[model samples]
Target: MVRSEWTKVWTTPGTAWLLITMVVATAGVSVLAAAVTGCPDTGCTVDVAKVNLTGVQLGQAVVAILAVLVVGGEYSSGMIRTTFAAVPRRLTVLAAKALIVTGVVVVTAAIAVAAALIISARLLPLSLGNGTVLRAAGGSVLYLGLIGLLALGVATAVRDPAAAVGAVLGLLYVFPIFGLATTDPDFQRHLQQIGPMAAGLAVQATTGLDTLPISPWRGLAVLAAWAAAALLAGGLLVRLRDA
Candidate 1:
């Protein structure tokens, strides 16, 4: 049953389009950023990896939609009942979906991040061999994959694709906007530290450490916490609710 579900996901037209969108969006954004933000003659001071992967912010929305549709679409179409009938175990079905979705998204994200970083490194004045560049590129991929999982979980609980997509996008983007809206430096700093985008993007900061709002790894961790919490809530709801 799990294998069947995996095949269905890959063969689905929506999944195919979403995967293409992810790749195109990630690569295109990286190229545009590189072209617009060239490095200085003395070498770039900006985090090249981060700049290249900037598309992830937009790309993640597609991922969230893809994740939501995996299950939410089924619910909307009344196909979930057939799925439950075939599998007979709600937790197992959810686990299988989560694992398959995570695996696919992670692999796609990793490739996109790697290609973006490599292409940007060549176009920009920065070197890809730098440790910081590696961390940012790799972490961006992981961060995106986790975001997919979080969206999947949310979709499971909501059982509505439109609502799940809106909720996930709001969760991911709202905090960052709120942080920017605040006038207080201290409060803004705190919000940046906790906000998924502000914090997650910290991994891409390779310059001005003293001026940074938070450490890169710590920022990624904050995003991870959000993803984990969403997944947990979704899991609980899935276990408690009807198919």
Candidate 2:
């Protein structure tokens, strides 16, 4: 089942194109950001790691769309019914898609993040040996992977490509906008603590850790929890609804 899903993902040209675009968009934005930003000889307080990985903010959208298409496309094309018929166990099918989608997204993200780091190394004072930088880089990759899983689960539950994409994007981008619009600091902080994008991206912070609403690792855990819950809900819904 996993092999079948893997083949389906690679055979799709749009998915491949999006993966390439993810790498380019991520690396390109990082380069642009690093070019404009600077640090002093005395060392700066700016979170250089986060700045260099800034392209991730855009790259994640692509990841979310691709993940949505993974399942939603099947539903749109009426292939999901055939998939369910062949697999018999609906949960197994979701698991397979989740595994394949997460695996591919993580690997592609690793490449994209590495490319961003390597290209921005000269523009920024990036140290490969620095543990903080390492953690930020590693965490950013995991962040994109988790975003993919979250989108996949949403697509599974929604079963509509356009609506699923909108829903996931709202969780990622819109929620933060709402947080920013809020007047209450406490409510805003609470929103960041639970928001998938805001919390997940916190893992990329290498400085000003004292001010973060949630710690880096803890923020990533928050995103993981969101993904897990989404998948659980999607699994139940998939079983309850007809393809």
Candidate 3:
């Protein structure tokens, strides 16, 4: 199952292009962010780690689209029926896709994050040896992987390319808008605590830990929970519904 899914993914030229776009988009934005922010004096307030990795906000959109297309593409091409005919167990198919998507996203995100870090480091004094910086870098990679899983689950559940892409992007980008629009501080904090994008990105914070609505690792966990829920819902729906 895994091998077959891997082949299917690689055979699509768009998949390769999307992965390349993810790397470029992530690194490009990070470089631009590093260029605009500076801390020449002591006691600088900037979270350099987060600033350099800022491109992730855009990179995630591409990741979500790639993940959605993984499953949604098959459905659109009428190949899902053939897939099901080959493999009677629907859940296994999903599991294989989840594994492949996670692997590819992690590897791609690692490359993108590394490029961002390296290039951004040239602009800012980034200490790769620092424990906090290391955590932020590693966490960013995992964050992207979990996001891929979240999108895949959503795509599987909806079984529509356009709708799946819209739903996933809305879930990631819309909540922050709601948080920013409201006047209530407590409401804003609550939204951040529950929102996948806000919470997940919290891992990038290198300073002012006390001010965040959720802790770094805990914030990533919130995103992981969201991904798990989405996958569970998708798995159930895929099994119950006809392809």
Candidate 4:
């Protein structure tokens, strides 16, 4: 099942394109972020990992879109029936897609993040000593992979390419929009604590940890919960629905 799904993913034209898009967009944005910004004050505190990895925000959208197309495209093309006919196990099919999607996203995202940080290594202040840099780098990679999983689950549930893509993007951005529009501090903090983008990105912070709305690892856990819930919902729907 895994091999078949893997073949299906690689044979898809957009899979390579989307993965390329993710890497280029991530590295490009990181380069731009590093190029445009600098130390403005003497007592400056900036999260180098977060700054260098700013491209992940853009990269994640590409990842989500890619994951969406992996499943949703099958529905759009009426190929899902064929897939299920061959596999005969709905959950297995979804699991294989999820795993393949994660594997691709993780590899490309890791490369993107690594190259971004390396290229911009000169631009950063570099005062974040000890394991902070390692944590930030590792966490950023994990965050992108999880984002892909979240997108996969969403795509599996929605089953339509356009609608599933829209839903995934909404999940990534809507809470942040509401958080920005609201004036209530408590509400804003709550949104940040739960919003996948706001919370998951916290893992990339190498500075100002005390001021974060949610602890770094805990914030990541929130995202994990979101992803798990999405996948579970999607699996249920897949099991119940007609192929």
Best by TM-score: 3
lDDT for model 2: 0.92
lDDT (Cα atoms) of all candidates against the true structure? 0.84, 0.92, 0.94, 0.86
Least accurate stretch of 10 residues (summed lDDT) in model 3? 36-45
Candidate 1, 1-243: lDDT as tens digits: 679779879876678889889988988888888888746555666666667777888889889999998999899989899988888778788889888888999999988887777776677756677887778778888888888888988998899999999999888888878877889899889988998778887887777767888998899899888888887888888778887
Task: Count backbone clashes in candidate 2.
Answer: 0
Q: Which of candidates 1 and 2 reaches a greater lDDT?
A: 2
Least lDDT summed over 10 consecutive residues: which range in candidate 1?
Answer: 38-47
Summarize candidate 4's per-residue lDDT along 1-243 as a digit string, tens digits.
999989999998878888888889998898788766754434435666778778888999998888888899899999999999998889999999889988888888889888878777666545344487778877888898998889889888999889988998898899999998999999999999999989998988878899999998999999999999999999999999998
Native-to-model Cα distance after best TM-score fit, residue 209 in candidate 4, in Å: 0.8
Collision pairs in model 4: none
Top candidate by lDDT = 3
Instruction: Compute the lDDT of residue 110 as modeled in candidate 3.
Output: 97
Q: Model 2, range 1-243, lDDT digits (tens) per residue?
A: 999999999886698899999999999999898878756455666778898999999999999999999999999999988998899899999999999988999999999999999998778867877999999999999999999999999999999999999999988887699898999999999999988889988999988899999999999999999999989999999999878
Q: What is the lDDT of candidate 1?
A: 0.84
lDDT for each residue of candidate 3 in 1-243, tens digit (9 for 90 to 100): 999999999997699999999999999999998887755454457999999999999999999999999999999999999999999999999999999999999999999999999998988768988999999999999999999999999999999999999999999988899988999999999999999999999999989999989999999999999999999999999999999
Please report, as a residue range, the 10-residue window in candidate 4 with the lowest summed lDDT. 38-47
Model 3 lDDT, full chain set: 0.94
After superposing all C-alphas onto the true structure, candidate 1 shows an RMSD in angstroms of 1.8
Give candidate 2 regions above 4 Å deviation.
40-43
- Clashes, model 1: 0
